[model samples]
Target: MREKLQHVAGRVWLYPHDPDPEAIGACVGVIADDRGSVLIDAGNSPAHAREVQQAIAAEGLPAPRWLVYTHHHWDHTWGAAAWPDVEVVAHSSAVDLLTAEAERPWSHQYLRDQVALDPKLGPSFRARALAVPDFGELAIVLPHRTFDDALTLPTGVELRHVGGSHAPDSIVALDPGSSVLLVGDCYYPPPFHLRTDDDGPDLAMARRLLAEKHAVSVDAHSAPRSGS
Candidate 1:
């Protein structure tokens, strides 16, 4: 079932609540107006992608015109293939990661672990997921537009690409009118695990970034927090 997060204005739908916490990472974003909507990050698989699509549809908003990848993690970018012909945007470094030749081995290993941990993923789904080409093979269709620092799309939404914090090309989105910020993976609450491969900025810096915006901030793993 899709879980909806309530906000004073607009709403956020979180995806995949299966037994395994990492099975399908959540996709976050808002729905408003008729021109279209914005999606923060795509989920882990095509199945998760469909769930996100359905969630967005249920919100009664137009199909997403712009989809932003908060980072280039396989869990975040793989489902992008299911999003159709939307204008996908990401940081320049994310684009590079998605287009790099060395991504497949790491991506395959990650997906394999996710599938193993969640038998709910099943064999057929695992096969299909494994078949999809890695980021380097599908970069052309994945993220067509890339930005360095900050870029604003239509509808008063601004996406600021902050240098590698959680990953090499992490980004955060801010809706000035709503004063809501969508940050993926950079600010997980408590019980923090220190993994060697985790790159980019630290949670403290992420907190500082949220503080600077003075917007209500939502981390990828938890509910929204007051930026103040």
Candidate 2:
């Protein structure tokens, strides 16, 4: 099912999905007063993006005005291309990775690995996965404005670039008034085989950081876990 969480103050809707048995990620939606909205972390494929779009339509929310990628990973950013003429935002390092991927030839082997890792997807999903061009041809639009440590959105949301734990340029968003923090993939549930040759969490650091907030903490995962 399409899991959801609501932020009343910001009118933000968080959609969570367990794409794999051990892994979960979320796509965020922020509704503007009467204007369009913004999306955070498009899912792993255009199909996922379309699913998000359909959900928004069902809810009568405004179409996403922008797409914000939490980090530079396939599961989070691969569906970005589905949005038309929308501004996409990500860290500089993320842009570098997306750019690099766009130029290389499509790798069927990599697609196979993705399928093997997430067997929940069907044959059509695999087709779209393998069809993605390298980063160069992927139309990876860079962030119009880049931030080093901290940045605030027009809606009075403050996002801070916490030091990299999951990837070289990961950032966390904190809503001081509401005490809600959006941490990307820094602290995934332990069940997933997180430790890998290249990417995973710095468990000790993540644990410490996770302790700071006494309020709700959201990740690109299934649900918002308590920070306390």
Per TM-score, the best of the predicted structures is 1
Q: List model 2 lDDT by residue over 1-228, tens digit each.
A: 354445534465666655563233345645443445667677766666667777777777777766666676666776777777667766666767677766655455656676588764445345445435443334444565556767766655566666554566677766566666677775542223344455555677667667785377676754676646
Q: Residue by residue across 1-228, what tens digits does model 1's lDDT show?
A: 455434434444344233345343555565454677777887665556777787667756678888888887656766777888678889888766777723445455666775687655444345435435453433323488888889988877788866543576878887777777777765442212323444433767665875676557766666566756
lDDT to native, each model: 0.64, 0.61
Model 2 stretches astray by more than 4 angstroms: 1-10, 22-26, 29-35, 107-141, 188-200
Model 1's alpha-carbon lDDT is 0.64
TM-score of the candidate numbered 1? 0.73
| lDDT value for model 2 | 0.61
